[model samples]
Target: MTARHRFDPTILREYDIRGVVGITLCEADAHAIGRSFATVVLREGGRRIVVGCDGRLSSPMLEKALVAGLTASGADVVRIGLGPTPMLYYAEASATDIDAGIQITGSHNPRDHNGFKFVLHGHPFFGAAIQNLGVMAAAGDWEEGAGTCEDRPVLAAYVNRLLEGLAGVDPARLAALRIGWDAGNGAAGPALERLTARLPGEHHLLFTDVDGHFPNHHPDPTIEANLADLKALVAREKLDFGVAFDGDADRIGAVDAGGRVIWGDQLIAIFAEDILRRQPGATIVADVKASRTLFDAIARQGGHPVMGSSGHSLVKAKMKEIDAGLGGEMSGHVFFADDYYGFDDGLYAAVRLMAATVRLDRTLAQLRDAMPETFSTPELRFPVDRARKFAAVGEVHARLAKAGAQVVDIDGVRVTTPDGWWLLRASNTQDMLTARAESDTREGLERLIGEIDAQLALSGLSRA
Candidate 1:
């Protein structure tokens, strides 16, 4: 008998498979994903698959079902147990025996949400690849055999690899720093605990206990509200700086000694300075949503700056294409191929940030203070009809093109005006239209935002 499964249409996102657990996604879906993915792997002449899960309560059940599907398809499964998404990436990237990897994580989403992220043959498996899984599952197009599953813990090795980001830093300067970390009770907790134990400095950790309910706060560090705890921790401890991680610990958020939230692009600028110093004229990539200031900073340092489409997987693909030494996003997904593998790892970013501070001989706050001042709106996401979101952006793009506005449409429409810039793009993961604007003056920022509003209004929508 052939086995066929149908996924909830909404779960097949552009970057990964995600949905609200028990509602739109379930154990059966996990099984189908495993079976389908394993079939693809077998077709590619690969048999070994690595899997890991986050701290979510539903992860264990999904992992069990997923493994069953994989093994049924004759794919050998190596389960890395519980850890951050990067740990799964690390296992796959470092192991010669591994052919592909998947991480069961909800990322920075709400507690009830859960999903899977994948890497195959050292490349991101997403977009069309993700959609094909659904097609294969619905057709029951899977190989059959009884393969085996085994557990191999990689947390220790993963932590050690993260420490390598600081390999050349002076131990004395590192020890002189005082830092704070907020894991937000995500999968990074255990790894953070282990890394901090070996790191030099006075470290204060918040929400390191893995709690699926996220009793204290949500794990999304990009949101200002979510960083309240981290900010308070830094202020109370008088630490040099603080770093935070999202649910699966792939995205990062930070605060300096004065407790100001350092946005993602600003962090890239800091990293770019150090990296360009070592590898001059190297290409540095940043997503379209990043500030113009960051692009100029990279260029000023004699580094080539490339604007990438937003989304971690897309940025990673672009980085690989351009052979970029560093890449990042406004959402805090930083990738480093200079001293480490080109993947977004929050823990590794933290270590590199520390090393940068030590080598530059400047406080984190000082590095932040040196960035050009620009007033910008945070990512403004508003719900739109799933079918209409992309259309709306297209309409805006066409209108802007007709108007002869300076536009960069690498991902969406980023209008570069005399003020600064404004971006309008559809969210790849959700049925929402995301917008952002920046400028040197408050008045200019308002005008840029007004332009965004006008464009959205023309598309029969409004930020309100």
Candidate 2:
């Protein structure tokens, strides 16, 4: 008889199963996830699964335990050992017979934390599917049989595929451009080093060694402070632009020749311009936190602009539903359903960015300068009790509705004004409320901020 298992309920999240290792998550939880997930796959008539792990210290142990449960549950496992989360997504997307994929990754979290991201039949496995896995684990209802496991190293193939994004890019122009890349010693390091080696350009790389400790810096690039090293490198080398990736290489960050950080919305704007040029009137999606300038820019470029909910899974679903050519978020997850798979891959985004620059006949700095000026607050995250975050958004939404304010409540409450817009939403991944405001002028921006503060006060909270 097989042993029964129960996972810590808190480890199951909106988009993935995550927790601090040894505290809320362990090898046992990993095994339970594999068994339960395999059972679910089998119920759906799926028989093969792909498993991948990051370079974290805890990943190997988790992967071992997970494979045991998966094989025991009668699912053939293709173990793509030691790669980024996107690599797992690629493996599943590219496989002819694979039914599911799971990646053991800590993402951009601190060293002590880890988690799993999943894809089922080429779609994100999240929300209710995550909760169902917990229920199945608790019931000890899993398939049992002897299943096979195979080892496959796919880094070189993945890197080669990324280069395909540069098909129409001018090679002479690519060679003329100097670029810098920083992987922050995360799982994306080795892949980045391999990618740049074959690309056309004067290339320089930083911290290409896989170090889960992240001794150089935290792997998250969205936070401006974490990008200090990359910015310094770009400046020192006078590169045309610099690119960086989050821990698992799913999120991207960039800086131009002047070492100015390019926000995610701005990156999408660049991508939209290039993509819309070829596929006119294509639907392009950006999350609510994206700058209004991005939406306006997409429209000006003859593309349909869509404001999507603020989560990668939600955005991906929306993209498929609308057959969107491109979709992205302010947090740096760019998805391309145009010429590539509709999954968020930072390395792929970087490749497309290079192609965009070369094809447009403009350097990154020139592209940045071409955008209209807008004053926007950096994403503000304030602590709120987990239980009250959603309720608070609901409360704010009611008041806005009552006042007949011009608002968009797709994800949260985004009030639009003659000056600009302000948004308040509960973060899906953390116990916090996120807010942002943007305007054409400083005074208008202040008004938008004040509106956000006023809305928060109504919920008996203060921005921190």
Q: TM-score for each prediction?
A: 0.99, 0.98
Compared with the true structure, the alpha-carbon lDDT of candidate 1 equals 0.95
Q: Which residue pairs show backbone clashes in model 2? A: none
Q: What is the per-residue lDDT of model 2 for residues 159-262, given as tens digits with 9 covering 90 to 100? A: 98999999977899888989889898889988888889999988989888998899999999999999999899999988999999999999999999998999
Clash numbers, per candidate = 0, 0
- lDDT by residue for model 1 (12-109), tens: 99999999999999999999999999999999999999999999999999999999999999999999999999999999999999999999999999
- Top candidate on lDDT is 1
Write down the worst ten-residue block by lDDT for model 2. Answer: 1-10
